[model samples]
Target: MISLANSAARRSLRTVSQVRTLSSGIDIDVDHYSSGWNIDDIGEFTAKTGKYQIKTFNKISEKGLARFNPEKFEIMGSDWDSTNANAILLRSHKLQESEIDVSVRAIARCGAGTNNVPVARCSELGIPVFNTPGANANAVKELVLCGMLLGSRRIVDGVNHMKDLGAQGLAKERVEKDKSMFGGQEIKGKTLAVIGLGHIGASTARDAAALGMDIVGYDPGLSIDSALKLPNEIDLTDSIASAVANADYISINIPYIKGENGTHGIIGKNVISSFKPNAVLLNFARGELVDSEAMKEFLDNGDGRYVSDFPDDLLWDHKNAVILPHLGASTEEAEDAAAAMAADTISDYLQTGTIVNSVNFPAVSLPARPDGAIRMSVINKNQPGVLASITDVFAKAKLNIVQQINQSRGDVAYNVLDIDPTANHEAISMKDLQKELTMTDGVLSSRVVFGTPGCGYARNIDGQYWV
Candidate 1:
């Protein structure tokens, strides 16, 4: 079972402001961030969706809430109604199986992991999930340094040992006599194996190199941007086994992709057996990435230690386990950046049908359509002729296609169409058109909207709920 922090239960749906005009308004529900981010920018951009309303929870950042233009949109208190909420902006609050709302067209998480949000269920519901991937890179990188230091040196043990002395009579003498027991090697000149050279991994390698630690890294999924961010001195490893075998310390920075062929127990028997006898293993990633049974067996047989932010029952209270509360992305700056990014991405999706950092859908962003043009967004099963069938409905309605784009992610596909009836504007009825599009086989959800160029929000009132 996956367990989150105690703060996860504080489920809050925050910020929404409604416009007084008769135009269709999008209701954006804001929630509490761990450190409370500045999302006034989100409110401002979302206002482009003609008349819009923002509903915020009591825990919303005061500075962010104040950014909303009070003259344009109605701001309500915590008792505000959210039945019409178009989206959810959140941080750590978990959206479990039965809690997923049908009205929410999308969910934008302030941080990287979507574990708190049921991503698979969102995909099934055809609701996009957005996350700020590198927004907390620096915060996690610094924490990696902290974990490495704690693992290599007996700093925590030393501090605990000193605290036990209590400055009693002759305490200084007692401390001086027992200091050697807490002694461990310094990090300088030690080899550090960094698995998953993504944002956090690359940053950690660069900083660790500056501190004189030799860096060995491996990441099959490393992007070009991440590769450019790495220090030139790092030795690129051919495999995890090779990297772990050669390092004095190992840092696992990969995300947990559940059920991937080699994911579950990625740091299993082979890697654990090859570790330097007294080496330190750090897992700031996910708990399921490491095989707890193998880790327990390894630690029981040697002087090695394991440091992890996500600890299961096997690692809890173990002599060599240095378990930490998941504090990698807990810094104030990280929280603010993540929340701001998440808000911006979500606003972009709602106003323009452009998805940038969506976890469930492939990234797609199109140029703004001309004024008075209608737009259609369809989420359907990934299969042949799904696009043609959607376009056929538009063609039969005698709509001129201004621009169209289609993208697929795994088993689902998202299509966007910009239509202009030109002289036949009276012939195209949006209400009837949406009905026809939704009736198409393989179509999960469809929305038809018209207004200013970036003023239309996709309203999915008939979204399928997956429990």
Candidate 2:
């Protein structure tokens, strides 16, 4: 009878282990830093896709998408809307490989540059960087034109007056400023100067033309052929000043950068002072592209009507200037597109490591683990015996190690360990493991995660739904 009971107990344990392994599909990383989306959206693609174990924030040490099964899973980009996504990928991560297959749709953060994301990092890591550059070009370009027209026409004044407490203030001012400012100048048939012919600039020029505004494009990067599609009466100038000098309204579409020579003040104080008296200035680009103080002084004291969407102190606190909290691509269409595109990228990376928009690492397509064990990503000192220390903790816990991957960062080591525990133990119970890791002389930080395939990221969309 005792022998029979032992046999039954062994079978039960095996069944539990099998269920745990069978339940292994993909582990999506959940955190506040990520936009809400997960691998569950790509269920039809991976039929053999394992059980998805929900991973916690502190469990994974690799930031952004690196925590997603770093070993077997290769994160990369692809034409998500076109491809059969049998893999998972992530957005907002640096891809580390080259000559990779990808499905990527990337739109910049409304006039943002590939500037902050270095190409060398992607090239060295063997990853390809492709962007959906013109994806939302029309939408943003239209907004820029609208901003310019409004700046020229002072439409913000109308919007502001409705919010004001003074009765009849708007009615009184509308009749007064319309004929008063610039002797009643309208945006129609006026010059619209654009500083960049990149995606947004391209859009701005095209749309501004429709509104009967003459376009003046000044970009050192754009060729004459590309500039030809601009307004028929538009002017193309080599100098930045040539664009600003003859404009009834100015739009700075340059990417934002910090530092003295970092294009922070491309529209310098000197350039601003040279503007036509009462010339309208609008910046729908990065905040650092223009000189905030000079612009404030120019608008507040000079003869100009300033309207912008940037969050500069001068723009927000001043009356003439209109400030928006970086809502260029905040439209429902843009948000939905971004969310879907980012999701597809993350899902692809999770399954195949095909990193399309990654800043580092090559794009790859592979599983995180073969045996379907819990994936733990650790970022720590790369010194000798660090791996031994981590493995020993699992050894002490009497867990079975299935696979381990360690990527070195200079002197630090990022380790991904897949393990089978002896019993049901919450990975967070590894506080002792965390303490032991922090206590290690060389260990920087330790984390654990469930490996799905792509970037593991999450947020409470409906809020309180996770409960």
Worst 10-residue lDDT window, candidate 2: 458-467
Model 2, range 24-93, lDDT digits (tens) per residue?
A: 3322222211111222233332221232222211111133334344444443344332122222233234
**All-Cα superposition RMSD per candidate:** 8.8, 15.0
Candidate 1 at residue 357, lDDT?
A: 87
How does each model score on TM-score?
0.81, 0.51
Model 2: how far residue 195 lies from native, Å: 1.0
True lDDT of residue 51, candidate 1: 37
Clashes of each: 13, 68
Highest TM-score model number: 1
TM-score of 1: 0.81
